[model samples]
Target chain A: MYLAKIKVTYKPSVLDPQGEVIKSALHRLDYETVEQVIQGKYFEVRLSADSLAAANGLVESMTEALLINQNTETYNYTVEEVEA
Target chain B: MYLAKIKVTYKPSVLDPQGEVIKSALHRLDYETVEQVIQGKYFEVRLSADSLAAANGLVESMTEALLINQNTETYNYTVEEVEA
Candidate 1:
């Protein structure tokens, strides 16, 4: 089996209002040292694949096709082989 | 400076309906090899602190206090010191 850990985040140019709100909340809570916060989605996917290459391809395709909005968000993932 | 990469996920006993939906969607899309999917929240926090220990402590406290609900979710984070 292969386990893929994927993180989807906004492009640097994008304005993350939720992140901004969270940062403001932190500051209100007295975490004055906090400089920035970027909030994203994480997914753990377990799948059977013939090889690491196949696993990576599956994850890449799946993420790009369904998990993210190409115009507003981007994703990166790491696929690791695991015992089934 | 310190950067904290945090992942918040539901406890093992908790049911994740969103994950189930995603898994079903993937199956419909012909990702039949997919076995399981777990969806989660990821946060990247940048903060300034006096030392590495302080940074870790700050991340821990802020996460526990604001970012996660203790009843259903748990979080893990990696803290790295970065050039200021």
Candidate 2:
């Protein structure tokens, strides 16, 4: 088995309203030192594959096809082998 | 300056509807090898602090108080120094 840790976030140019809200809330809560906050989605995917290379390929394709909006969002992931 | 990468995830016993939905979608898309999907929130926080320890402390407190529900969710973070 392989466990893929993926993070999907808005592109730098995209506006992230949720992150903006959180930043303002933090500032109001006295965390004035907080300069910026970028909110994103995290996913842990466990799958069975023949090898590390196969696992990576599957994860990348799955993430691209189903997990993110290609225009406004981007993602990166790390895949690690794990015992089933 | 410091950059804190935080991940907030539900406790093992808690239900994750979004994850379940994604898992079903993946299976439908022919990713039958996928065994599980756990969804969570990710945050990139940039802040000004005196030291790495101070940054870590601030991030921990902020995350516990604002970013997660202690009753159902747990969080982990890594703080690293960054160019201002």
Candidate 3:
């Protein structure tokens, strides 16, 4: 088995409402030192592949087709082998 | 500065469309061993607080107000001190 860690984030230039809200919340909490707040996602996936090569190929296709919106978001992932 | 790593994910009972799509993609790529796929988000935030206590307070409020929708999702974060 292998563990795949996937991350998805909005394009930097795009405005993030969620981030803005967080920034405002920080300000209200007197954390004026925070200059910005950006929000994103993280996923840990368990794969049942027998080999690393096969697992990687699967994750690649998964990221390209579902985990990310190619036009607005970008994704990156890492795979680690787990001891059985 | 302190770094806050925030992770957001869907509630387990909820159906994750993105994850399902990714699962199909993996199948097409011949990774038939994958039984499930769950998608989520990751965020890295840099804070300019002078003390760790202040930074923690800020992140807490941020998570409650914007980083996560308490009703639909849950979030957790870690703060790390960085050298100047």
Candidate 4:
């Protein structure tokens, strides 16, 4: 089995309202050091694949399909082997 | 200034309770294909530093100090130059 970790984030040009809210909250909570806050989605999948290459192919297809919307967001992933 | 995108996620071995809740929610929403929903924090920092190396240094320090709890969570980052 293999483990795939994916991260999805909005494009830099887009405005992140969720992040803005969190930034304000942090400021209110006295976290003045926090200059900005951007929120993104994280996914960890346990693949049934036999090898790293297979796992990567599965993850890449998933990312390109329903996992992310390429129009407004971008994503990247890393894969590792799982020890049984 | 450089743009630093940092992603923080829980260690794979640890069970993610938040992800469980989201997974259940997705199932209820009829999104059965959604196998898991692990959530993580993302930060988009606009550094005051002049170069990518300096920005990386700042980001590393920030990650080590407060952005990530190394004991339970791990983080990775990518830096890019912002065109003027």
Candidate 5:
């Protein structure tokens, strides 16, 4: 099986309200050491593909079509093979 | 500066509705090869700490106190130095 490690996050230009909230929460907890907290979605996708190349293509398409929003968010991912 | 890569996900025992919805969407997109998807929270935490050990300690406490909910989710993180 292939596991696609997907991460989708807001564009740098976009304001991240959730991140701001978490950052404030951290400060409230007396963690003044925390400088910034940028939050995003993480996904571990398991799929069946013939080869590494095939898995990469599949994951890329999945990421483009459903996992990420093109206008507001950008994403990055890595694919690795694992024993099923 | 330090960059902490944090991931928090639902425990295995919990049902992931968002993941299921995405899986179904993938199937609709003819990605029948997709087996499963586990979704989680990802954070890119930028902070200042004295050293790697200090960064790790700081991130751990932050994760425990603010970033993750102990009862329903589990988390893991990696800390690395980055240019400010």
Candidate 6:
């Protein structure tokens, strides 16, 4: 089986109020050193594929088509094989 | 600088309607081979820390206090040193 961990985040130019709120919450918790908290989406995708290359191709296509908003968000992923 | 990528997902016992919807959409797009799509939250955290150990400590505490709801969600993270 193939497991894909996909992350989609707002582009740098986009405003992320959720992220800002989380950052503020962290600040309130006395985490003064940390900054720029951007909140996005995480997709845990599992599929049966012949190979890593095949899984990557299908996942990349999925991201472009539905998993991400191309105009406002940027995405990246990692593909791994796990024992089913 | 320290960079932390954190993922928070609903526990297996919880319902994930968002993930189910996405999976159905993918199925409509003829992605029959793929299955079990679970969607969650992704956090990109940046901070200035003296060491990776310190960053991990603060970040972990942040996760417990604010990031993930321990009752229904499971969380994991990766911390790295990044160039500012």
- Chain B TM-score against the true chain B, each candidate: 0.97, 0.97, 0.85, 0.90, 0.95, 0.92
| Cα lDDT tens digits for candidate 4, A1-84 | 666788888988988898887667655654454566677787776556657787788778766766678888898889888664
- Look at candidate 1 and give me any clashing residue pairs: none
RMSD value for candidate 5: 0.9
lDDT top scorer: 2
Model 2, position A42: C-alpha lDDT score = 96
Residues B8-50, model 4: lDDT tens digits: 8888887789878756755665445445557677777664565
Ranking by DockQ: 2, 1, 5, 6, 3, 4
Q: Model 3 residue A51 lDDT?
A: 89
Query: Per-residue lDDT for A1-84 in model 1, tens only?
Result: 999999999999999988888899999999999999999999999999999999999999999888999999998899999999
Q: Using alpha carbons, what is the TM-score of model 6? A: 0.94
Model 2: residue B25 alpha-carbon error in angstroms:
0.5
Each model's chain A TM-score: 0.97, 0.98, 0.87, 0.92, 0.95, 0.91
- Model 4 chain B — which ten-residue stretch has the worst lDDT? B26-35
Docking class of 5: high
Give model 3's docking category.
medium
The DockQ figures for the candidates are 0.93, 0.94, 0.53, 0.25, 0.89, 0.86
Task: Give model 6's docking category.
Answer: high
Clashing pairs in 3: A40-B42, A41-B41, A41-B42, A42-B40, A42-B41, A42-B42
Give the local distance difference test score of model 3: 0.76
Interface Cα RMSD per model, in Å? 0.4, 0.5, 2.2, 4.7, 0.8, 1.0
Candidate maximizing DockQ: 2
Model 5 lDDT tens row, B2-34: 999998999999899999999999999999999
What Cα-based lDDT does every candidate model obtain? 0.95, 0.96, 0.76, 0.72, 0.92, 0.93
Model 3 residue A57 distance off true place after TM-score fit, in angstroms = 3.1
lDDT of 5 by residue, A56-84 (tens): 99999989999989999999899999999
